[model samples]
Target: MRIVITGGLGFIGLALCRRLLEAGHAVRLVDSLSPQIHGALPDVLAPEGAEVLRADVRRLGDHPEALADCDAVYHLAAETGTAQSMYRIEEYTDVNATGTAALLQALARAPRRPRKVVLASSRSVYGEGAYAAEGTGTIVQPGTRSKAQLEAGQWEPRGPRGEMLRPVPTPETLPFAPSSVYAATKAAQELLLLSAAEALGIEPVVFRFQNVYGEGQSLMNPYTGIISIFFNRARQGLEIPLYEDGLESRDFVHVADIVDALVAALQADVPPGLPMNLGSGEPTSVRMLANELLAASGFKASVRVSGQYRVGDIRHCYADLGRARDVLGYKPRVSLAQGLARFCAWAAQQPAYQDRLDAAAEELRRKGLGT
Candidate 1:
């Protein structure tokens, strides 16, 4: 198969490139090399046979000929920061929403369209609407603050009383309550892809990804993976900061598993308009993640509880994965502990990881937090 991967040099994109190349598939990589998340391409993607182009997906219509021959496209390029989106809302909309629309239009005009287009959606689209039930078996809203916040805190509902809130793992059917511009753009792209598929005969597959973490991740990027940030801080014996008492949970999916599910989706003979969750289906709290990393890295570190929560943070957001397993034949093979160990081992050998971590710490220190 011939595959064109947009944002092919990114953390997940590069990993996908390596996997496709190893599978003996012809690979073409298109990336804009945006200053924000650009990193060196992996050795596997540096081969002479691979096609590499410096093109933005937003301008994909200008080069319809470039995507003319590919069998499928894994659209992974986007403005991927949630916190930064609060400030740079327009930029997020332009790149993620408008850029995706431009690519869909290009595909529509292409002489030989790709058979399938897999979009990388996000669990963040659920936003503050995702939560878990408490010991009282009552569902709690994600945004409520409490006075006695433990290291592993819990959620409390904020709305009207006597309303029964059900606690079910968030499926793709859940209504999107995107709190950040980044998430909003993702939700918008998902809708656009589905609508385009229905209206224009394009085959679109949407994977709403959970928290993805693994090798080649930027430890210095404040907006990148939390596990990467914690690993970097723990290696230096710095205080590991926990947001909202460290109990807020997320389903951390490995990059390898993500690629596996994507490949499965691409190979399936299913029709367009299929949306599924790509996740481990297990929730891990920030405190538990920090402990696991400490155990994995042999780092003795003190955790600092900031007791400060982000405005639109989700308390518990994990996928059911039933649809993914049945439709895409996907199952996450790497456990959180195993993934953390592997990542730490790889990170300890890289000077770039340490440098990025130090720079991030200095920036945070200047802001008088997360030292």
Candidate 2:
């Protein structure tokens, strides 16, 4: 297939570009090159015969010619993370929302259409994920904990009679409770692309990615990926910080597994225009992951459970993966220990941590985005 991937130079995008090229597909990548995401540009995003464009997808309507004759379009460009997006509202809206709008507009005006269109949606849109009341046991989307609750250091949502709600794997059917601006933008991006592509008689697929991590990720970025942040901190012998009593859990899926889900969606007979959760379906707590990274990194550092918690951060949320399995025949092959080992090896090749996490947290504090 001939393909064009927006944000093609990004960590995920570049990985996709390489996979597609290996499969003998002609690929073209479109990227805007935001410095916040890419600390430094690599030698090339696309492998030896593929094309790369240092262009913004927000201007895609003006450059519709580049997408001509492509068999599919993978939209992966966006500002990532919840806490960072809470303060940088305009950047998230412009890059993630408006950029997607331009791509859809270009497709609408173009003379030809592609066979498929896939979007990089996120699990963050589900907020606290599907939860069940302890007594009644009815599944529901528990809303974010109140400021008063957060102030009292109560992390979990409460049912009537003060019963604790237990978080379950968030399925695609869970109503969106996007807690941060970034999550809202991603949720909006999925709706816009799916609706627009369906209107144009094209099949659209949305993959709500979990915490995707592995090789080639930006270790400098502090606002996302707890695994990378912990790894970077360990390399410097800095203390590994955990928030909210260190029990908050998330689903971490390797980048290779994420690529498998995308490839399956592209080729499989998945029902069109439905979002699927892409994750390893295993929940790992912050404290456990921190300990694992510390052990794997061969570094000595105390794990501190900071009472501080970021506003809009969830207590626990992992992917159900049922839909992904049935729809795309997807199953994560990388175990957490294996993935951590791979990451630890990758960390040795990267530069030492610069302690940007403090600055990142301060940026949020300056805007009251953190509690």
Candidate 3:
């Protein structure tokens, strides 16, 4: 199969490119290679015979048709950040939301179209997620977290009678209630790709990925990937900071497992339908992740549990990987501990870059995005 992948030069995209090449598929990659994601373009992005198309997903004349001569496309390009998205509203929307539209428009003008379109969606679309009330045993899915609630440092959602709610694994059936501009863009990407694919006589598959972390992820990008941020802090012997009482949780899926699902999506005999989650299905707290990364890297710095919470942040959300398991026959092979250990071993050999998380936070504060 000839495959075209947008964002195909980044961490996950490069891995997919390698795998597709190994499977005897000719590959072409479309990417802007933003400095934030890739500090500098590496000399080599893939095995020989793979082509790289240099273009921004939002820019015309070079996108969409980049998918020409391909059997399928894995749309993975986006501006990703939860807290930063609160401030960089226009950039996130332009890249993630309008970027998808550009691809569809490009497809509309093309003489030929890829038979299948696979979108890389995020789990953030399920804001607040499905929660079970402790007292009433009822399920509740709330909307956005108010600025008042965030200002008061009330991180978790509550029931009518003040009952504590437990985080439940959110499924695809739950209505979208994205809190941040980034999450909203992801939801919009899904809607746009699927709707446009249907109208254009193309098959579309949407994968709502969990927090994917592993080797090749940019350790210097402080605005995204908590694991990479912690790894950077550990490399510099700096303290890892935690927000929201250190209890906020996420389903941290290994990038390898994510690639596995992506590969499975190519071969699986499943119908194009609603978004399906690709995750480990196990929730790990922020503090726990920090501790694990530090320990994995053999760093002695203690994590700081700062009570300050970022605006547009969620308290707890994980994947309900049932649909992925059933439909794609997917299972996560690399455990968190195993994946972090591998990343640490590889990172120890690389130059430890400066940790810019504090600077990122300061930028957010200057823009009045976070408290």
Residues 1-371, candidate 2: write the lDDT tens digits. Answer: 89989988878888888898888889998887877667665444456877877788899876866688888999998889789887779988998999889888888887988888899999989888888888788887877787678879998876655777888888999988998899999989988987787788778899999999888787778888788888878778888878889998999989989988887777877687678999999899989999888887788888998888888888889999998899888999998889888988987887675768888878877887674
Which ten-residue region of model 2 has the weakest summed lDDT?
37-46
Alpha-carbon lDDT of model 2:
0.85
Q: What would the per-residue lDDT of candidate 1 be over residues 1-371, giving only the tens digit for each residue?
A: 99998888778888888888888999888888776565454332444466888788999987775586988999999988775675667988999999999888898888787888899999888775444454355544443333333223444444344343444577776777786678889999998898888666668888999999988776666666888788777777788888776876789988999999887877786556667888888888889998998999898889877775544455667888988888878889999988988898988886544435445445544543323
Candidate 1 backbone overlaps, count: 0
lDDT of 3 by residue, 1-371 (tens): 98988888888898888888888888988888888877765543565778988888877446545867778889999999888888778999999999899888888887887888999999889887788988777888866777788788888888767678898888889888998989999999989987898788888999998899887888778889888888888777788888878988989988889998898889776676768998889999998888888878888887888887788888888888888899888899999999989988887887777889999988887887776
* Per-model TM against the reference: 0.86, 0.96, 0.96
Off by over 4 Å in 2: 40-45
What TM-score would candidate 3 get against the native? 0.96
Q: After superposition, how far is residue 339 of candidate 3 from its true place, in Å?
A: 0.9
Candidate 3 has which clashing residue pairs, if any?
none
